[model samples]
Target: MSGARYWRHQDQRYNMAGNECGVCGSRFFPGKTMCPNCHRRSVGKMKKFYFNGNGKIITYTIIHEGSLQYRNQVPYLLAIIELEEGDKVLGQIVDCEASDLAMGKKVEMVFRKLGEQGKSGTIQYGYKFILK
Candidate 1:
Protein backbone atom coordinates (compact mmCIF):
# COMPACT_ATOMS: atom_id res chain seq x y z
CA MET A 1 0.00 0.00 0.00
CA SER A 2 2.81 2.41 -0.93
CA GLY A 3 2.21 3.12 -4.58
CA ALA A 4 -0.30 4.85 -6.86
CA ARG A 5 -3.17 2.48 -6.18
CA TYR A 6 -2.45 2.56 -2.48
CA TRP A 7 -2.63 6.32 -2.33
CA ARG A 8 -5.75 6.22 -4.43
CA HIS A 9 -7.59 4.10 -1.88
CA GLN A 10 -6.29 6.21 0.98
CA ASP A 11 -8.46 9.13 -0.03
CA GLN A 12 -11.05 8.42 2.63
CA ARG A 13 -13.28 11.32 1.75
CA TYR A 14 -13.80 9.88 -1.69
CA ASN A 15 -16.84 7.66 -1.47
CA MET A 16 -15.30 4.26 -1.93
CA ALA A 17 -16.76 4.41 -5.43
CA GLY A 18 -15.66 5.77 -8.80
CA ASN A 19 -15.39 3.44 -11.72
CA GLU A 20 -16.76 4.03 -15.19
CA CYS A 21 -16.96 1.76 -18.18
CA GLY A 22 -16.17 3.46 -21.47
CA VAL A 23 -18.07 0.76 -23.30
CA CYS A 24 -21.18 1.45 -21.26
CA GLY A 25 -22.49 4.33 -19.20
CA SER A 26 -22.31 2.27 -16.08
CA ARG A 27 -20.76 3.31 -12.80
CA PHE A 28 -19.45 1.15 -9.99
CA PHE A 29 -18.10 1.43 -6.53
CA PRO A 30 -14.75 0.09 -5.29
CA GLY A 31 -13.63 1.27 -8.70
CA LYS A 32 -13.86 -1.67 -11.04
CA THR A 33 -10.98 -2.14 -13.45
CA MET A 34 -13.39 -3.67 -15.91
CA CYS A 35 -17.11 -3.66 -16.49
CA PRO A 36 -18.89 -6.59 -14.90
CA ASN A 37 -21.94 -6.42 -17.06
CA CYS A 38 -20.46 -5.52 -20.44
CA HIS A 39 -17.26 -7.45 -19.86
CA ARG A 40 -15.23 -4.56 -21.29
CA ARG A 41 -11.90 -3.52 -19.91
CA SER A 42 -12.20 0.04 -21.22
CA VAL A 43 -12.65 1.59 -17.85
CA GLY A 44 -11.54 4.97 -16.55
CA LYS A 45 -11.77 7.06 -13.45
CA MET A 46 -15.11 8.63 -12.75
CA LYS A 47 -15.57 11.87 -10.89
CA LYS A 48 -14.79 11.65 -7.22
CA PHE A 49 -17.78 12.03 -4.94
CA TYR A 50 -18.68 11.82 -1.28
CA PHE A 51 -21.75 10.60 0.51
CA ASN A 52 -23.18 11.94 3.74
CA GLY A 53 -21.85 8.71 5.25
CA ASN A 54 -25.18 8.27 6.93
CA GLY A 55 -27.30 5.24 6.19
CA LYS A 56 -29.63 2.54 7.46
CA ILE A 57 -28.53 -0.64 9.15
CA ILE A 58 -29.35 -3.59 6.96
CA THR A 59 -27.35 -6.26 8.74
CA TYR A 60 -24.47 -6.79 11.19
CA THR A 61 -22.32 -9.12 13.22
CA ILE A 62 -20.11 -9.03 16.27
CA ILE A 63 -16.44 -9.94 16.05
CA HIS A 64 -14.80 -11.55 19.07
CA GLU A 65 -11.60 -13.06 17.73
CA GLY A 66 -9.83 -10.19 15.99
CA SER A 67 -6.52 -8.41 15.68
CA LEU A 68 -4.71 -7.03 18.71
CA GLN A 69 -5.45 -3.53 17.50
CA TYR A 70 -9.19 -4.20 17.78
CA ARG A 71 -9.26 -6.97 20.33
CA ASN A 72 -10.09 -4.53 23.09
CA GLN A 73 -12.81 -3.07 20.97
CA VAL A 74 -14.60 -6.42 21.20
CA PRO A 75 -18.29 -6.80 21.04
CA TYR A 76 -17.65 -4.31 18.24
CA LEU A 77 -20.01 -4.23 15.31
CA LEU A 78 -19.46 -5.03 11.67
CA ALA A 79 -22.57 -3.88 9.88
CA ILE A 80 -24.05 -3.53 6.46
CA ILE A 81 -25.34 -0.06 5.82
CA GLU A 82 -27.57 0.98 2.97
CA LEU A 83 -26.84 4.51 1.85
CA GLU A 84 -29.48 6.93 0.59
CA GLU A 85 -28.44 6.18 -2.97
CA GLY A 86 -29.03 2.47 -2.46
CA ASP A 87 -25.36 1.55 -2.29
CA LYS A 88 -24.54 -0.72 0.62
CA VAL A 89 -21.22 -1.06 2.44
CA LEU A 90 -19.88 -2.85 5.49
CA GLY A 91 -18.57 -0.80 8.41
CA GLN A 92 -17.98 -0.86 12.10
CA ILE A 93 -20.68 0.52 14.35
CA VAL A 94 -19.35 2.46 17.30
CA ASP A 95 -20.69 4.36 20.31
CA CYS A 96 -23.70 2.12 20.78
CA GLU A 97 -24.60 -1.28 22.12
CA ALA A 98 -25.56 -4.16 19.85
CA SER A 99 -28.91 -4.30 21.59
CA ASP A 100 -29.40 -0.68 20.63
CA LEU A 101 -28.92 -1.49 16.95
CA ALA A 102 -31.37 -3.11 14.58
CA MET A 103 -32.27 -3.42 10.94
CA GLY A 104 -33.52 -0.13 9.46
CA LYS A 105 -31.80 1.84 12.21
CA LYS A 106 -30.27 5.11 11.04
CA VAL A 107 -26.54 5.57 11.31
CA GLU A 108 -24.26 8.54 10.79
CA MET A 109 -20.68 8.28 9.64
CA VAL A 110 -17.91 9.59 11.82
CA PHE A 111 -14.18 9.62 11.22
CA ARG A 112 -12.68 7.07 13.58
CA LYS A 113 -9.12 5.98 14.23
CA LEU A 114 -8.88 2.55 12.67
CA GLY A 115 -5.59 1.11 14.00
CA GLU A 116 -2.26 1.99 15.59
CA GLN A 117 -1.12 4.43 12.94
CA GLY A 118 1.14 1.95 11.17
CA LYS A 119 4.42 3.20 12.72
CA SER A 120 3.29 6.79 12.36
CA GLY A 121 1.99 6.57 15.96
CA THR A 122 -0.93 8.61 14.63
CA ILE A 123 -4.02 6.50 14.10
CA GLN A 124 -5.41 6.12 10.61
CA TYR A 125 -8.77 7.85 10.29
CA GLY A 126 -11.73 6.16 8.64
CA TYR A 127 -15.51 5.90 8.82
CA LYS A 128 -17.58 4.29 11.54
CA PHE A 129 -21.30 3.78 12.02
CA ILE A 130 -22.93 5.45 14.98
CA LEU A 131 -26.53 5.13 15.97
CA LYS A 132 -28.38 8.17 14.82
Candidate 2:
Protein backbone atom coordinates (compact mmCIF):
# COMPACT_ATOMS: atom_id res chain seq x y z
CA MET A 1 0.00 0.00 0.00
CA SER A 2 1.11 3.56 -0.49
CA GLY A 3 2.12 5.64 2.52
CA ALA A 4 -0.83 7.97 2.19
CA ARG A 5 -3.34 5.17 1.93
CA TYR A 6 -1.79 3.27 4.80
CA TRP A 7 -2.06 6.24 7.14
CA ARG A 8 -5.56 7.02 5.91
CA HIS A 9 -6.83 3.68 7.18
CA GLN A 10 -5.01 3.69 10.51
CA ASP A 11 -8.22 3.69 12.53
CA GLN A 12 -9.57 0.68 10.69
CA ARG A 13 -6.28 -1.21 10.74
CA TYR A 14 -5.65 -0.57 14.41
CA ASN A 15 -9.01 -0.09 16.06
CA MET A 16 -11.40 -2.23 14.04
CA ALA A 17 -13.31 0.91 13.15
CA GLY A 18 -16.02 0.03 10.71
CA ASN A 19 -19.54 1.19 10.00
CA GLU A 20 -22.85 0.18 11.47
CA CYS A 21 -26.12 0.60 9.67
CA GLY A 22 -28.42 3.03 11.43
CA VAL A 23 -31.43 1.41 9.79
CA CYS A 24 -30.85 -2.30 10.44
CA GLY A 25 -27.98 -2.15 12.95
CA SER A 26 -25.82 -4.32 10.76
CA ARG A 27 -22.05 -3.87 11.18
CA PHE A 28 -19.26 -4.20 8.67
CA PHE A 29 -15.51 -4.17 8.78
CA PRO A 30 -13.78 -2.14 6.07
CA GLY A 31 -17.09 -0.36 6.41
CA LYS A 32 -19.22 -0.03 3.38
CA THR A 33 -20.90 3.14 2.16
CA MET A 34 -24.27 1.36 2.43
CA CYS A 35 -25.59 -1.57 4.43
CA PRO A 36 -26.10 -4.81 2.62
CA ASN A 37 -29.13 -5.61 4.72
CA CYS A 38 -30.93 -2.31 4.81
CA HIS A 39 -29.88 -1.16 1.33
CA ARG A 40 -31.50 2.16 0.44
CA ARG A 41 -32.55 2.87 4.00
CA SER A 42 -28.96 2.55 5.13
CA VAL A 43 -27.49 4.92 2.59
CA GLY A 44 -26.10 8.08 4.18
CA LYS A 45 -27.01 6.67 7.58
CA MET A 46 -23.98 4.51 8.32
CA LYS A 47 -22.27 5.34 11.58
CA LYS A 48 -18.74 4.66 12.69
CA PHE A 49 -18.28 1.92 15.25
CA TYR A 50 -15.18 0.71 16.98
CA PHE A 51 -15.00 -2.97 17.76
CA ASN A 52 -13.81 -4.09 21.19
CA GLY A 53 -11.34 -6.45 19.54
CA ASN A 54 -12.40 -9.62 21.30
CA GLY A 55 -13.22 -12.76 19.38
CA LYS A 56 -12.89 -16.51 19.03
CA ILE A 57 -11.04 -18.45 16.39
CA ILE A 58 -13.45 -20.03 13.93
CA THR A 59 -10.74 -21.72 11.89
CA TYR A 60 -7.02 -21.30 11.16
CA THR A 61 -4.09 -22.56 9.18
CA ILE A 62 -0.35 -22.55 9.72
CA ILE A 63 1.19 -20.85 6.72
CA HIS A 64 4.53 -22.33 5.83
CA GLU A 65 4.78 -20.42 2.60
CA GLY A 66 4.14 -16.79 1.73
CA SER A 67 5.19 -13.88 -0.44
CA LEU A 68 8.47 -12.04 0.10
CA GLN A 69 6.79 -9.45 2.24
CA TYR A 70 5.70 -12.14 4.72
CA ARG A 71 8.58 -14.56 4.30
CA ASN A 72 9.87 -14.01 7.81
CA GLN A 73 6.51 -14.81 9.21
CA VAL A 74 6.33 -18.20 7.58
CA PRO A 75 4.78 -20.87 9.77
CA TYR A 76 2.69 -18.20 11.38
CA LEU A 77 -1.01 -18.64 12.04
CA LEU A 78 -3.72 -17.06 9.92
CA ALA A 79 -7.27 -17.29 11.18
CA ILE A 80 -10.86 -16.31 10.72
CA ILE A 81 -12.05 -14.73 13.94
CA GLU A 82 -15.71 -14.42 14.83
CA LEU A 83 -16.01 -11.14 16.69
CA GLU A 84 -18.32 -10.75 19.65
CA GLU A 85 -20.46 -8.43 17.54
CA GLY A 86 -20.95 -11.12 14.88
CA ASP A 87 -18.53 -9.90 12.21
CA LYS A 88 -15.91 -12.37 11.07
CA VAL A 89 -12.44 -10.97 10.26
CA LEU A 90 -9.21 -12.37 8.97
CA GLY A 91 -5.99 -11.63 10.85
CA GLN A 92 -2.69 -13.07 11.86
CA ILE A 93 -2.37 -14.99 15.11
CA VAL A 94 0.69 -13.91 17.03
CA ASP A 95 2.41 -14.55 20.38
CA CYS A 96 1.02 -18.10 20.59
CA GLU A 97 1.98 -21.52 19.46
CA ALA A 98 0.12 -23.62 16.94
CA SER A 99 -0.16 -26.45 19.47
CA ASP A 100 -1.94 -24.15 21.87
CA LEU A 101 -4.68 -23.04 19.45
CA ALA A 102 -7.94 -24.77 18.66
CA MET A 103 -11.34 -24.08 17.19
CA GLY A 104 -13.21 -21.63 19.40
CA LYS A 105 -10.07 -20.56 21.28
CA LYS A 106 -10.46 -17.04 22.60
CA VAL A 107 -8.33 -14.32 21.09
CA GLU A 108 -7.91 -10.55 21.35
CA MET A 109 -6.60 -8.02 18.89
CA VAL A 110 -3.28 -6.20 19.18
CA PHE A 111 -1.53 -3.60 17.06
CA ARG A 112 1.51 -4.76 15.13
CA LYS A 113 3.60 -3.86 12.12
CA LEU A 114 2.09 -5.32 9.01
CA GLY A 115 5.10 -4.67 6.76
CA GLU A 116 6.94 -1.86 5.06
CA GLN A 117 5.61 -0.45 1.82
CA GLY A 118 9.04 -0.44 0.19
CA LYS A 119 12.64 0.37 0.95
CA SER A 120 12.59 3.24 3.45
CA GLY A 121 8.83 3.52 3.00
CA THR A 122 6.30 3.83 5.77
CA ILE A 123 5.98 0.99 8.26
CA GLN A 124 2.42 -0.23 8.03
CA TYR A 125 0.61 -0.88 11.29
CA GLY A 126 -2.38 -3.14 11.75
CA TYR A 127 -4.10 -5.55 14.11
CA LYS A 128 -3.26 -9.13 14.89
CA PHE A 129 -4.72 -11.41 17.53
CA ILE A 130 -3.34 -13.56 20.31
CA LEU A 131 -4.73 -16.38 22.39
CA LYS A 132 -6.35 -15.24 25.58
Candidate 3:
Protein backbone atom coordinates (compact mmCIF):
# COMPACT_ATOMS: atom_id res chain seq x y z
CA MET A 1 0.00 0.00 0.00
CA SER A 2 1.00 3.63 -0.36
CA GLY A 3 2.90 5.23 2.48
CA ALA A 4 0.23 7.85 3.04
CA ARG A 5 -2.61 5.42 3.53
CA TYR A 6 -0.52 2.95 5.50
CA TRP A 7 0.61 5.57 7.98
CA ARG A 8 -2.87 6.99 8.28
CA HIS A 9 -4.19 3.71 9.68
CA GLN A 10 -1.12 2.63 11.58
CA ASP A 11 -2.62 3.38 14.94
CA GLN A 12 -5.87 1.54 14.44
CA ARG A 13 -4.25 -1.42 12.74
CA TYR A 14 -1.38 -1.85 15.14
CA ASN A 15 -2.92 -0.96 18.45
CA MET A 16 -6.52 -2.00 18.04
CA ALA A 17 -7.41 1.58 18.77
CA GLY A 18 -11.11 2.24 18.83
CA ASN A 19 -13.65 4.62 20.25
CA GLU A 20 -16.13 4.28 23.06
CA CYS A 21 -19.47 6.02 23.03
CA GLY A 22 -19.89 8.26 26.02
CA VAL A 23 -23.63 8.04 25.81
CA CYS A 24 -23.94 4.27 25.99
CA GLY A 25 -20.38 3.24 26.89
CA SER A 26 -20.28 0.92 23.90
CA ARG A 27 -16.86 0.46 22.37
CA PHE A 28 -16.10 -0.07 18.71
CA PHE A 29 -13.01 -1.24 16.91
CA PRO A 30 -11.25 0.70 14.11
CA GLY A 31 -12.87 3.74 15.61
CA LYS A 32 -16.24 5.20 14.79
CA THR A 33 -17.38 8.74 14.16
CA MET A 34 -20.77 8.07 15.66
CA CYS A 35 -21.86 5.37 18.04
CA PRO A 36 -24.12 2.79 16.44
CA ASN A 37 -26.15 2.38 19.59
CA CYS A 38 -26.70 6.05 20.33
CA HIS A 39 -26.56 7.23 16.75
CA ARG A 40 -25.83 10.98 16.31
CA ARG A 41 -26.39 11.80 19.94
CA SER A 42 -22.90 10.49 20.64
CA VAL A 43 -21.28 12.08 17.64
CA GLY A 44 -18.76 14.19 19.50
CA LYS A 45 -18.97 12.27 22.75
CA MET A 46 -16.72 9.46 21.69
CA LYS A 47 -13.56 8.73 23.66
CA LYS A 48 -10.44 6.93 22.58
CA PHE A 49 -10.38 3.26 23.59
CA TYR A 50 -7.42 0.95 23.34
CA PHE A 51 -8.25 -2.74 23.40
CA ASN A 52 -6.22 -5.33 25.30
CA GLY A 53 -6.61 -7.68 22.31
CA ASN A 54 -7.97 -10.57 24.34
CA GLY A 55 -10.91 -12.17 22.62
CA LYS A 56 -12.54 -15.32 21.28
CA ILE A 57 -12.93 -16.61 17.76
CA ILE A 58 -16.57 -16.49 16.79
CA THR A 59 -16.14 -17.91 13.32
CA TYR A 60 -13.44 -18.46 10.73
CA THR A 61 -12.56 -19.73 7.27
CA ILE A 62 -9.54 -20.69 5.24
CA ILE A 63 -9.21 -18.82 1.98
CA HIS A 64 -7.72 -20.55 -1.03
CA GLU A 65 -8.30 -17.54 -3.27
CA GLY A 66 -6.49 -14.33 -2.45
CA SER A 67 -5.68 -10.91 -3.82
CA LEU A 68 -2.56 -10.14 -5.82
CA GLN A 69 -0.73 -9.05 -2.72
CA TYR A 70 -1.70 -12.20 -0.85
CA ARG A 71 -1.43 -14.70 -3.66
CA ASN A 72 1.50 -16.48 -2.08
CA GLN A 73 -0.27 -16.62 1.25
CA VAL A 74 -3.30 -18.52 0.08
CA PRO A 75 -5.17 -20.75 2.54
CA TYR A 76 -4.67 -18.16 5.28
CA LEU A 77 -7.15 -18.21 8.11
CA LEU A 78 -9.54 -15.30 8.57
CA ALA A 79 -11.63 -14.98 11.68
CA ILE A 80 -14.11 -12.79 13.41
CA ILE A 81 -13.03 -12.25 17.00
CA GLU A 82 -15.30 -11.04 19.72
CA LEU A 83 -13.32 -8.91 22.13
CA GLU A 84 -13.79 -8.93 25.87
CA GLU A 85 -15.26 -5.47 25.57
CA GLY A 86 -18.13 -6.91 23.54
CA ASP A 87 -16.85 -5.61 20.24
CA LYS A 88 -16.03 -7.81 17.27
CA VAL A 89 -13.24 -7.31 14.74
CA LEU A 90 -12.22 -9.20 11.62
CA GLY A 91 -8.54 -10.10 11.32
CA GLN A 92 -6.24 -12.76 10.00
CA ILE A 93 -5.21 -15.67 12.19
CA VAL A 94 -1.52 -16.44 12.07
CA ASP A 95 1.18 -18.38 13.93
CA CYS A 96 -1.16 -21.36 14.13
CA GLU A 97 -2.50 -24.16 12.01
CA ALA A 98 -5.95 -24.29 10.49
CA SER A 99 -6.72 -27.56 12.24
CA ASP A 100 -6.29 -25.88 15.59
CA LEU A 101 -9.01 -23.30 14.99
CA ALA A 102 -12.44 -23.73 16.49
CA MET A 103 -15.44 -21.67 17.51
CA GLY A 104 -15.11 -19.84 20.84
CA LYS A 105 -11.40 -20.44 20.96
CA LYS A 106 -9.40 -17.86 22.91
CA VAL A 107 -7.14 -15.54 20.96
CA GLU A 108 -4.76 -12.67 21.45
CA MET A 109 -3.80 -9.85 19.16
CA VAL A 110 -0.42 -9.64 17.49
CA PHE A 111 1.35 -7.13 15.28
CA ARG A 112 2.57 -8.39 11.92
CA LYS A 113 3.70 -7.13 8.56
CA LEU A 114 0.79 -7.04 6.15
CA GLY A 115 2.98 -6.56 3.10
CA GLU A 116 5.48 -4.24 1.50
CA GLN A 117 5.63 -2.16 -1.65
CA GLY A 118 8.44 -3.39 -3.84
CA LYS A 119 11.81 -2.62 -2.29
CA SER A 120 11.51 0.87 -0.85
CA GLY A 121 7.92 1.97 -0.84
CA THR A 122 6.63 1.01 2.60
CA ILE A 123 6.18 -1.96 4.94
CA GLN A 124 2.64 -2.12 6.17
CA TYR A 125 1.98 -3.43 9.68
CA GLY A 126 -1.33 -4.66 11.03
CA TYR A 127 -2.87 -6.80 13.76
CA LYS A 128 -3.53 -10.50 13.59
CA PHE A 129 -4.82 -12.98 16.12
CA ILE A 130 -3.42 -16.21 17.49
CA LEU A 131 -4.62 -18.86 19.85
CA LYS A 132 -4.05 -17.98 23.44
Candidate 4:
Protein backbone atom coordinates (compact mmCIF):
# COMPACT_ATOMS: atom_id res chain seq x y z
CA MET A 1 0.00 0.00 0.00
CA SER A 2 1.03 3.58 -0.48
CA GLY A 3 2.53 5.39 2.48
CA ALA A 4 -0.27 7.92 2.55
CA ARG A 5 -2.97 5.27 2.49
CA TYR A 6 -1.27 3.18 5.13
CA TRP A 7 -0.77 6.14 7.45
CA ARG A 8 -4.35 7.26 6.94
CA HIS A 9 -5.68 4.06 8.51
CA GLN A 10 -3.09 3.88 11.29
CA ASP A 11 -5.56 4.67 14.02
CA GLN A 12 -8.08 1.95 13.15
CA ARG A 13 -5.42 -0.64 12.42
CA TYR A 14 -3.36 -0.01 15.50
CA ASN A 15 -6.03 0.76 18.04
CA MET A 16 -9.27 -0.91 17.01
CA ALA A 17 -10.71 2.57 16.84
CA GLY A 18 -14.29 2.81 15.56
CA ASN A 19 -17.27 5.08 15.88
CA GLU A 20 -20.45 5.13 17.93
CA CYS A 21 -23.75 6.77 17.15
CA GLY A 22 -24.79 9.19 19.83
CA VAL A 23 -28.37 9.12 18.60
CA CYS A 24 -29.09 5.39 18.67
CA GLY A 25 -26.13 4.05 20.62
CA SER A 26 -24.86 1.98 17.70
CA ARG A 27 -21.20 1.24 17.23
CA PHE A 28 -19.18 0.44 14.11
CA PHE A 29 -15.73 -0.67 13.21
CA PRO A 30 -13.50 1.29 10.82
CA GLY A 31 -15.72 4.13 11.99
CA LYS A 32 -18.58 5.62 10.04
CA THR A 33 -19.58 9.15 9.21
CA MET A 34 -23.24 8.38 9.93
CA CYS A 35 -25.04 5.67 11.80
CA PRO A 36 -27.12 3.33 9.66
CA ASN A 37 -29.78 2.85 12.32
CA CYS A 38 -30.31 6.46 13.33
CA HIS A 39 -29.78 7.89 9.84
CA ARG A 40 -30.46 11.67 9.81
CA ARG A 41 -30.32 11.95 13.56
CA SER A 42 -26.79 10.55 13.53
CA VAL A 43 -25.47 12.92 10.89
CA GLY A 44 -23.32 14.85 13.32
CA LYS A 45 -23.63 12.60 16.36
CA MET A 46 -20.99 10.02 15.60
CA LYS A 47 -18.21 9.87 18.17
CA LYS A 48 -14.94 8.03 18.28
CA PHE A 49 -14.97 4.73 20.15
CA TYR A 50 -12.00 2.66 21.26
CA PHE A 51 -12.72 -1.04 21.64
CA ASN A 52 -11.46 -2.81 24.75
CA GLY A 53 -10.40 -5.78 22.55
CA ASN A 54 -12.05 -8.39 24.71
CA GLY A 55 -14.22 -10.78 22.74
CA LYS A 56 -15.25 -14.35 22.00
CA ILE A 57 -14.96 -16.44 18.88
CA ILE A 58 -18.40 -16.98 17.38
CA THR A 59 -17.01 -19.19 14.59
CA TYR A 60 -13.68 -20.02 12.99
CA THR A 61 -11.80 -21.75 10.15
CA ILE A 62 -8.27 -22.88 9.56
CA ILE A 63 -6.52 -21.49 6.51
CA HIS A 64 -4.25 -23.95 4.82
CA GLU A 65 -3.86 -21.77 1.74
CA GLY A 66 -3.29 -18.10 2.21
CA SER A 67 -2.91 -15.21 -0.19
CA LEU A 68 0.37 -14.01 -1.65
CA GLN A 69 1.02 -11.61 1.18
CA TYR A 70 0.26 -14.20 3.80
CA ARG A 71 1.36 -17.44 2.18
CA ASN A 72 4.10 -17.90 4.72
CA GLN A 73 1.55 -17.88 7.48
CA VAL A 74 -0.70 -20.51 6.01
CA PRO A 75 -2.37 -23.00 8.29
CA TYR A 76 -3.40 -20.15 10.54
CA LEU A 77 -6.71 -19.78 12.28
CA LEU A 78 -9.22 -17.04 11.46
CA ALA A 79 -12.43 -16.32 13.29
CA ILE A 80 -15.42 -14.07 13.55
CA ILE A 81 -15.02 -12.45 16.92
CA GLU A 82 -17.89 -10.92 18.82
CA LEU A 83 -16.40 -8.10 20.83
CA GLU A 84 -17.54 -7.52 24.36
CA GLU A 85 -19.09 -4.22 23.35
CA GLY A 86 -21.05 -6.10 20.61
CA ASP A 87 -19.25 -5.51 17.32
CA LYS A 88 -18.26 -8.59 15.38
CA VAL A 89 -14.84 -8.51 13.70
CA LEU A 90 -12.83 -10.91 11.58
CA GLY A 91 -9.30 -11.48 12.82
CA GLN A 92 -6.55 -14.07 12.75
CA ILE A 93 -6.15 -16.17 15.86
CA VAL A 94 -2.46 -16.41 16.74
CA ASP A 95 -0.18 -18.34 19.06
CA CYS A 96 -2.43 -21.37 19.17
CA GLU A 97 -3.25 -24.46 17.21
CA ALA A 98 -6.47 -25.24 15.35
CA SER A 99 -7.10 -28.05 17.79
CA ASP A 100 -7.10 -25.53 20.58
CA LEU A 101 -9.92 -23.40 19.19
CA ALA A 102 -13.70 -23.74 19.26
CA MET A 103 -16.81 -21.62 19.01
CA GLY A 104 -17.46 -19.30 21.96
CA LYS A 105 -13.82 -19.36 23.05
CA LYS A 106 -12.55 -16.25 24.81
CA VAL A 107 -9.95 -14.04 23.15
CA GLU A 108 -8.17 -10.72 23.51
CA MET A 109 -6.43 -8.46 21.05
CA VAL A 110 -2.68 -8.35 20.70
CA PHE A 111 -0.53 -6.00 18.66
CA ARG A 112 1.71 -7.69 16.12
CA LYS A 113 3.25 -7.36 12.68
CA LEU A 114 0.56 -8.00 10.10
CA GLY A 115 2.57 -7.89 6.89
CA GLU A 116 4.71 -5.65 4.73
CA GLN A 117 4.14 -3.79 1.51
CA GLY A 118 6.95 -5.79 -0.05
CA LYS A 119 10.43 -7.06 0.71
CA SER A 120 11.72 -3.51 0.99
CA GLY A 121 8.47 -1.75 1.64
CA THR A 122 6.68 -0.63 4.77
CA ILE A 123 6.32 -3.00 7.70
CA GLN A 124 2.69 -2.90 8.71
CA TYR A 125 1.56 -3.49 12.28
CA GLY A 126 -1.93 -4.27 13.49
CA TYR A 127 -4.09 -6.14 15.98
CA LYS A 128 -4.55 -9.94 16.04
CA PHE A 129 -6.33 -12.11 18.58
CA ILE A 130 -4.89 -14.59 21.05
CA LEU A 131 -6.55 -16.91 23.51
CA LYS A 132 -7.20 -15.39 26.89
Instruction: Tell me the TM-score of each prediction against the true structure.
Output: 0.70, 0.85, 0.87, 0.85
Error of 2 at 5 (Å): 13
Report the alpha-carbon TM-score of model 1 versus the true structure: 0.70
Estimate candidate 2's alpha-carbon lDDT, on a 0 to 1 scale: 0.85
Candidate 2 regions exceeding 4 Å error are: 1-14
Q: Total clashing residue pairs per candidate?
A: 0, 0, 0, 0
> How would you encode candidate 3's per-residue C-alpha lDDT over 1-132 as one tens digit per residue?
677565766664347788899999999887899998899899899999888889999999999999897788998999999999869989899988999999999999888778887877687777899899
Off by over 4 Å in 4: 1-14
lDDT of 4 by residue, 5-122 (tens): 6665666435778888998888887689988888898998999888888899999999999888679999889999998886788999999999999999999987777777766767
Worst 10 residues of 3 by lDDT: 5-14
RMSD of 3: 3.4
Question: Sort by TM-score, best first: what order?
Answer: 3, 2, 4, 1
Model 2: lDDT of residue 115: 80
lDDT of 4 at 113: 77
- Estimate the TM-score for candidate 4: 0.85
* Residue 108, model 1, lDDT: 82
Poorest stretch of ten by lDDT in candidate 4:
4-13
Off by over 4 Å in 1: 1-35, 38-42
Top model number, lDDT: 3
In candidate 3, position 88 carries an lDDT of 92
Q: Write the per-residue lDDT of candidate 2 for residues 9-122, one digit (tens) a residue.
A: 666434678888999888887688998888888889999988888899999999999878789888899999998875889999999889999999999988777887767678
